[model samples]
Target chain A: MILLFLSSGLFLGWSLGANDAANIFGTAVATRMVRFKTAAITSGFFVIAGAVLAGGGATRTLGQLGSVNAMAGAFMVALAAALAVLWMTRAGLPVSVSQAIVGGIIGWNLFTGSPTSIDSLVKIVSTWVICPLLSAVFAAGLYVLARAVTQRSRMHLLAEDAMTRAALMAVGAFGAFSLGANNISNVMGVFVSAIPASSVHLFGFLHVSSDQQLFALGGIAIAIGIFTYSYRVMITVGKGLFRLTPVTALVVILSESLVLFLFASESLEAWLISRGLPSIPLVPVSSSQAVIGAVVGIALVKGGRNLDLRLFRRIAGGWVATPIIAASIAFFGLFFLQNVFDLPVHRPVVYELSDAGIERLRERGVDDEGLAELGGVAFKSARGLTGVLREKTSLGMIDRDVVVDCARRERFVVTRKRIDTLDLKLLTVGQIRALRDITGQEFNYWWELESTLTRESDQWAMLPDTRDNHPANKKLRSNLRQLLDAFRTVDTDD
Target chain B: MANLFARTRLLESKIDEYLNHTSEVGLLFREAMKNFLDGRLDEFEERRGKVCDLENHADELRREVERQLYIETLIPESRGDVLGLLEQTDDVINHVKHALMQVSVENPDIPDELGESYLELADYGSRAVQELVMGVRAFFRNTAAVPDHAHKVAFWEKEADKVAERLKRRIFQLNIDLSHKIQLGDFVMHVDSIADQAEDVSERLSISTIKRSI
Candidate 1:
């Protein structure tokens, strides 16, 4: 059953590998600078390494957009995204898995009546534009530097060829690694919430979390896709669109890799925050768009004689068309899955402005007087509560989100069985002790359980979101989210 | 990695050696002509034999370099251009050898006044060939320098043409048989054709350099 549910995500992962691997290794293989076998093996190994190691950052951002929250719903969403990509690929239009998956999540949100976080959506959609533009800038700068070096060095032609070949291989590997890190979220991120949390001990020593295991499976699927299908795409990409010399190909790959790395690297973001610098958001971006941007960048550096405005318009059209198509497919697919197949597409969450929720909203500085009128009324969905919040109170979007979150009624019971299921290795001694102290307690909301734990132990409390405490706060939040997921009881009464 | 660089260096040296053979053929051709004009037939024959040997050696080296380039897939974008350059330059060497062989086969009796002019024509042909080799070398290392050497090749070829015309005019005015004058004129044209071949190679080198520029 687990395999059946995960098949759609694996298919999505396969398609992602088939299409995006070309952006990394196309010119090198087409030009015979690097053999296809070498490229495949190097990329396959590094992609898996990257997915297991650095995939968490982009996955977290995707989770923020919309948590699918049910296995069958995740299956339909991933299936919809995969079908959209396959249709676009057959139609010979530019398509992105990241965009399609975002649309699928939005479709799921609409069907389940979940309020999609506007802040997360805006951040993700903005990257669709910014990602390509940034790649163009990086490519242009690198081109100038490469040309200057080749000219000033006066190296023999054969020696330069040898060096360029080696550089292409090295950069191709880095590009593959970055691609795996950034785009794994698109392939397996929905399944992250649907799958139950567990950890496995490998070789009796190395600990592997459930999320890592899922990502690794997705990575293997991507590798299979690369091995089975990407060669033809790489060849076509080499012959298609812009004609790239080996050196120019190197520049394009490097620029694309850098952009993917900037968006997907958690450590880089953390390091930048530690130094008080602005950090780039971890988002999965389109590798194909990045490749096109890089090619255009080189064309511009060469005076823009080869710029094709028609092709650009077509690609932009795809960026708009792919998401809408994916969303529609997901919406209809979910309806069929629920009606015909009798599947539970969503674990419905209920909201209510109880006295405790009202007090919590007031503590958070919200004007709760208007919310008091709606107290004790159980809303069927977050959108329903949001609608009432807008009608009754003049609250802003962020505050409304806070109100909805605080008013969400999730019953978390602290029992010995649930406490035993927690990964003791991931929690501090204080946190485990606090869990033991609250073994018999029950709460009507996630935040109530969180507050009880904070009162019992400082380890359960989040630190101020300062530069020094950012990582700690992030870890605390993750730990708290895990505990919440572990102890929550499903409300089946609709 | 070191092996890759070492292989490239070896190929570079082999190409250098082939170009050297071409330049050496030009020098031997000029010396053989000088010896023939100075009435040293034995020395002329010896230099002619050496020119033939160098031409054969250059052909073998060029073939090896071409094979290595294709096998290793080096400079894929410019490989065709480089091969064309090498073959055209080799044609110049073959021209020198043919011109020398013609002089040996058609041992025409030369008037004393025309001997110095003939030597001067051979000098210009040799210089043109040398300049063309430099242009080809610059195409490989410093494309910016190729035009300079190509321009020098054209200059020397023009000088050879002028010397050939004057020698032919002087031969026609000589108090000799019409058959002999025409034969000497044919010899002068043959030697001047060597410089013409160099000019053609230089022209090709110029275009190749433009293509190779980043």
Candidate 2:
């Protein structure tokens, strides 16, 4: 029975992963902000980390699927939800995992007692509207702000590039962490609860329960989903999700996260209700919807509803269908799983340690600073070379303050580390560690020089020598010749 | 957590350092090219001197990246292509330096008819290639920003094409030797491609951009 919960979660998680992971990296991949391999690996690892660590914000809205008492209730919910998401994915639809879960729970509930968590459900639905709308407004505002700053400062594009790259990385990392804290639970919570106690393993440092294992499985399912089927969805989001600037993405994500955090708080929801606020109350709804709404808000501010209506409609449909069909199927399926199969009459589903909550435990030894840093946290790192660079470029630090800070603070402690340059991969790992993490953004630093440096350098080479007879010209030509010869060798690996 | 945090921070710094390094070189290249095409030989010389130190530093970095690119066994793993791109990009910088060096060495100006148009052509070609370079940058960067490539390339190329055509007609009408005409014509192709490559980059960018639509 416990194994069944584990397997079901594993199965469901894969589906959820397939459905949701696309939403995370789709736009980035589409924009070529990062490649599929890079995005997938980055998103995958972060999503799991987020799932196990920070997830469960607004996760309880999903606590309503005891809708049917049938033996097959759970199975039906899983199957239907999975099918809806799969079908949507096939059609290149931008569906919401949050909504799918909601719909499945509701579909089951409508037939069962239909007793839903009004407080949680209301909040979730409200977020559906608020997240996207606020995100758009936020993005629009940020874009305007960015334009104003750049124009006022008259900062060159080099300065701007340095600033934006660092900023994008930070924003992306925060989103990933928040996602783990919030969404991981959605992927893993139910199955963990379904498991009975005897087979579960508990400890001070870890809980190796069937549920926890299932969560990992769910994460894998998501990884697979992203690898195999996520490309189309990624494309849609990149081009179709929003006409984004890096700043716009930052604004939309931050706004959506803020709204989610607000609704996530029980006190805030009650206060909003008491104050008769126009916005919906504390429901953990679709973050994608929030993002979309935010994009729309920005569009209205900048371009207006004249924004492509065709793509918007297609996206919205996926958001609508995911939850409803998922709920209905879950309700009926679980009903059958229990009754028709004559499965053990386990106690009715309670909010037994939601699987999402369990994800918070992990590799341990993480401290306050780490946790804080993992969140939208910042720290200062002092260094020597940054000053060297700043002086050399004379480009303003206003754009790259964070980067400068990072360089200053994170001192590399090489203990007589005369390492092998031959093991370049090993060296790059060191380089990667020196710069930051495994996220692929750092790799692109070299790639960006094609126009900026290469063309400039080439032009320099071709220019008429002011000292017509200067020996430097001879040296430059020979140097170029050697470089060109080296280039032609193709196999020389530079 | 702080330890992992620290690792990423350190790595980020290193990456930024490398990127900034590339960017600096890029800026130098851009300035040098601009000065060269404008016949500012002195300015090109001043800038060209800065490359010795930076290129030495970059050579180390490039070699490391190339080794890694191979060791990781990445697909499209042609080092030649990478080096070719790098070399061609670098060559343009050197070419600008050399082209200016020649002008200063010979102080040779074309006949008045060709001289004006040559300067104009070089100017157009330089700006056109600059835009192409920008296009290439935007393509790789993937920000909301892209160069106003079409207009820049079209305007510059259009102008360069016009001047080159006139220069060709005049060279023949001037009754220059067939060999010299061929040499002048060859020079024109080089200049044209500079503009054309920048324009060509837009075509590449467009294809990549269309991939977004797909």
Error of 1 at A461 (Å): 2.3
Q: How well does each candidate reproduce the native contacts, as fnat?
A: 0.56, 0.00
How much does candidate 1 score in TM-score? 0.93
Query: Tens-digit lDDT track for model 1 on B70-164?
Result: 99888887899999999998899888888888888988898888889999999999999989988888887788888899999999999999998
Instruction: Point out where model 1 deviates above 4 Å.
Output: A413-426, A491-494, B109-121, B154-189
lDDT of 2 by residue, B1-214 (tens): 2443444344334334444444455456456555655678788777666754565665565565556434533212123343343444444444444444444454443555576566666677677656655554543333234446656767787887888888788877876677767766765665555555545545555555433210
- What DockQ results for candidate 2? 0.01
Q: Whose lDDT is greatest here?
A: 1
Candidate 2 residues lying further than 4 Å off, grouped into runs, are A29-57, A64-76, A117-122, A146-169, A188-280, A294-308, A344-494, B1-214
